[model samples]
Target: MVDYGQAVDRQADEINPATVDQRARRLLRADEPAAANAPDTHLLQALSLVLTEGASDLHISGGAPPSIRVDGALRPIAGWDRWSPEKVADALGSILTPAQRVEFDKELELDFAYTINGTRFRVNFYQQRNTVGGAFRLIPNEIKSLPELGIPASVARFAHLPRGLVLVTGPTGSGKSTTLAALVDLVNRTRADHIVTVEDPIEFIHDAKKSMISQREVGQDTHSFASALKHVLRQDPDVILIGELRDLETISVALTAAETGHLVFSTLHTQDTAQTIDRIIDVFPPHQQAQVRAQLAATLRGVLCQTLVRKIGGGRVVATEILVTTAAIANLVREGKTHQIASALQSGRTQGMHTMDQHLAELVDAGLITRQAAEEKAMDVEVLKQLVRRIDPTDTSVGDLSNGEIDFNDSFSPGRR
Candidate 1:
């Protein structure tokens, strides 16, 4: 019933970056209901646009038409109607359960998953200056394989490991869930193991193949992540996929699971391997820090930090920093010298360990992403510049290493663990 194309064309004119930000701020301040109530099919219409446009995310906020993010850029639908607080609430009632409304009212923020016409979405509902807003991420019906996602074969090696902790971390929207699901799917196809997963709200639904999967939603199937993790060992699970290691208690339990010979997969909001290690250790009390570090050192199997960037032509490319733990790296963790982990990664190339900069540079070399874009997301600007120069001989923006532009001894020191 909606003329989707006409609506998009009409609304596209009003979607300049400045106007988007201005309207967002204005809506945040006013936070009042308007004259019209949104029609019952408002939410469905927006979702329909997402599928038709192949967008990854949809953002609904007051004082603006529903906007979709495609290939990392937000674009407002052309003919969509702007939303008001009361209208937003009315539209939300169609998808939210009565109990969910109560929870949303109590906490002011809620997360859950919903299905629309066979496509699933990971939904987040929250308040913005007293107005209801929602962020919806489209979850594809079919889980993509590692090769399909452009992940290196080296990453698949971790999926085959029988024990220890393997982390896939990055900022939100970095495709962590996708990668985790792919790994779990790999195990499900090749091994006759029991896989148990604990998620806040299970995103991907896995079918039994070579393995049997038991997915426990944090609030629904279990009281909380900590509670489920506490009893998971008794579940006789061979491979455990924890949605996140959010707190000290959960982290401790995950570490324990890995130490006891369970191959545990988890995610963290970290940018690199060193930072991931630091975050876990910093979560514990000072007195327990040393012991936690040693435990992590002994159990950490690998870390893959990923980021999604706009590709040269279209879609998006994944850049990853992989850390496959070795004896030397384990000793470094035990010795409380995490800052030196970057150098270890540089020299551990044979072992598949590399920094974020290395991954970004590789993308630049392969022409999947532009050097400027890669450099912008790069961790070490100097190193990225050198890499880009090496790949592109004509690039003279940064002097060569022979011209005193870089000091390898200072940057890549082989300090003892």
Candidate 2:
């Protein structure tokens, strides 16, 4: 049989000449049998590659070579053996605890946190085509501030609210967690309060500053988010960070927490501000919708929806739709006229509230991101085109960005084009 390692080495030599010495050194590290049986070796090497390449996510599947997402695209790691099902299982099994292993075996899917060489990773293990596979995203230890992330400065206000529900909504991988963490960290630094975070698998580790912090992982530290929320009020928490408001029970409790005078932060999988409001209200049964709306309108502090777009040169830029609840917005919510929320957002820019399209237009005019990329990420392409045209009415080239071929479902991180 041909040696998979040697074949990878040959491929690497063909593709990247500069890495020949590095490839030779890696090949000399271990014998074939030891390397093949110990999947940990392969996993560790792949993770190390993630660090060196400054990649955001690592992908491992049975039929293909392990790949890493560099910038916003997938680049396969060369000089690595193709993963086999048995090999993948062995590697994953070596890392998962007995309970996690049992859970994976029973459910065929799992999400957990793993640390290697001081770097933390958020891992999702799953079954694909009847075989085990996993995806890993590296979580940076330090949480970036809002300005550092290039988000609007108005977001800091949500952090300072004494009591209310702040929802950071976005598609997966849109930096929602990062933004939420930044907000929580802001509050942590600025206030002397007790903060409790209940996460599925705690991503960023927050050290106690002036504020006391207690982080609980869903499955491991507590039974679930609902369970933790049920008892959190008794813990004397001045601030609560819920990783995600994924269900009605969790959302209900979050609203209760907000109503009871503790600052609460959470996230939802939604695209824009109005849709985020509609989603939370629609989560309840028909009979509860009105009451839910009332509760939300009263307790909702703000909704910040974010999506990452390709910047002009390289890296990603965040286009955010901000909804800072005022009496006008609250009345709109209470009156059940959420359809008009978009109009409110457009006019409320002076109040630090703006739609995603408006933010995209600003980014385009500032030359921070390409008009094409902004159009592709906009909630309303035609609206965005009009916004751009207004900025440069004489420039007829604005319409070129409306190709209608862009897939909005894809999530991206800060990376090269």
Which predicted model would earn the best TM-score?
Answer: 2
The CA lDDT of each predicted structure is 0.76, 0.78
lDDT of 2 by residue, 172-245 (tens): 78888888888989998999999999998998889988799999998889987888989999999999999999
lDDT of 2 at 280: 93
List residue ranges in candidate 1 displaced over 4 A. 1-39, 389-417
RMSD of each: 10.0, 7.1
Q: Taking the candidates one at a time, how many backbone clashes does each contain?
A: 5, 2
Position 224, candidate 2: lDDT: 78
Q: Evaluate model 2: give its lDDT.
A: 0.78
Across residues 1-417, which tens digit of lDDT does each residue of candidate 1 receive?
222112132244344646444433332332222213322455666766665555668898888888987667788877677888787778775577667778888999988887654566788999889888999887766666776666766889988998999999998888888889889999999999999999988988899999999999876799888889989999999999999989999999999999999999999999999999999999999999999989999999999998776666555667788889999999999999999999998887778677888777766666566887887789998988776634564443422111111101100110101
List of clashing residue pairs for candidate 2? 71-415, 71-416
